[model samples]
Target: MKFLKIILATAIVLCIVLVATDYWISHKAEGYLYSKVADIPKNKVGLLLGTSKYIATGGINPYYTYRIDAAVALFKAGKIDYILISGDNSHISYNEPDTFKKDLVKRGIPENKIVLDYAGFRTLDSVIRAKKVFGQYSMTIISQKFHNQRAIYIAKNFDIDAIAFNAKDVTNRYGLKTRLREYLARSKAFMDIVFNVGPKFLGEKIPIG
Candidate 1:
């Protein structure tokens, strides 16, 4: 009887801790999303980080199109001058930056105004390398709002002048099940930063300028 009571108590306490930590991380991310999307300056450089795919319908994922669109909007709004496409290139077969470049070009964004980083193997790698290798201390981050919130959080922590141009969100029309995992992902992203987690791979230093 005493062991049963102790087990119940442990479970309850763990639930409380999980809820509290999740609440705090979610709230912190809320502030970042709410503030970062506004007041983007005219004529600043912009960065369009990669997503899971660049070939799915809606022309290579709504996230990719929206990111390109956001950068284009900033350019038309006179808020940015150049766009940097960064993502995984650990192997020749999996080329994210190239896909980004091709799509942006197809959308009429000039090739000369875009640069590619083929070594950004993950979110942390993209943002950090954008600063360390690409020399972007300040720039607009373009992606879906939920995803951009994480980017904004990382950028702020890294002391970059990062704002967001939220890409369009694909609805739960397919099924709400997809978003269900975001809860855990959000929590993990927070821990990833708090714990200073390193990327799966960090290739040789690439040029920034």
Candidate 2:
């Protein structure tokens, strides 16, 4: 009975820690998130965070589509001179950066204006690599609000000047799952900061114009 009570207490403490971390990250990022293209400050590079184009059920992921739309809008509005796609390429069949680049080009963005980082296997990697690998100390991050908040928090710790353009969010059951996952992710991010965790791969620098 005592062991069970201890387990229950531990669970409660963890839940509180998770919720607090989530709030802290989002609050830290409040002033940096913009929903409108006209309101955001322009940057030389817009870092489009990557996700799979399709969900596991074989439907187009709204997160992917909305991020692409946001990136295109930012480019056309002259808010960003280049689109740097950062995503995972861990598997031979999975190429997030390439997929995003193709979609952005199809949506009227010039191929030359898009840059790809094939090592952004995690959000931490994406945020840090923007500076360490891509030579961008300041950038406009493009993703959903929840994701942007976490990324901005990471950026601030790394001494990168970053703001985020919020992509249209998914509102279905999947969205709820993603949001719940984000709470844990935010907690992990806080711990990552505390421990000075870094990108898994930091290769030769690639300058972005």
Candidate 3:
């Protein structure tokens, strides 16, 4: 009977901790959004991170495409000077940054205005790589509002000048599943930054021409 009580207590505590942490991180990310939305500078670059397209489904509106489109809009608006599409280029079979580059070109962003980071295998990698590899201490991180916040938090942690532009709202699409996943991801990203988890690959600091 005592063991059962202890187990229940532990479970309850964990649930509370998870909910509290998720709420804090989500709101923290939201706060950054509120502060930077009206102030996204024209001088800053646009850094669009990548995600999968569910290749088997032939989906058109992947989160990644939306992000790139957001960057393109920023470029067209003259809100940003360049678009640095960074993501997982982990293998010959998987090349997100290249796909992002191609899509940007297709959308009328000049090739010279787009840069790719081959080793940005995760959000942390993208943020850190932005700072160390590309020398982007100040730029606009474009993604879904929930996503941008987490990235913004990490960049600020490293003392970088990162603002987030909430990409065209993606609602009633990913639903609760993606939000739950995002909550969990934000938590993990928070821990990773706190512990200073390094990237899977730290390629040579690619110079931006």
**Clash totals in order:** 6, 0, 0
Candidates ranked by lDDT, best first? 2, 3, 1
- What C-alpha lDDT values do all the predictions have? 0.69, 0.96, 0.77
Model 2 ranges with Cα > 4 A deviation:
none
For every model shown, what is its TM-score relative to the native structure? Answer: 0.76, 0.99, 0.87
- Least well predicted 10-residue stretch by lDDT in candidate 2: 200-209
* C-alpha lDDT of candidate 2 relative to the true structure: 0.96
lDDT of 1 at 108: 81
What local lDDT score does residue 103 receive in model 1, on the 0 to 100 scale? 72
Candidate 1: segments with Cα more than 4 A from true spot: 1-26, 29-39, 54-60, 173-178, 199-209
For model 1, residues 1-77, the per-residue Cα lDDT tens digits are: 99999999998986676666556655555644422334655435677788656444434455566676776677666
TM-score of 2: 0.99
Candidate 3 or 2, higher TM-score: 2
lDDT for 14 (candidate 2): 97
Q: Residue 22, candidate 2: how far off, in angstroms?
A: 0.6
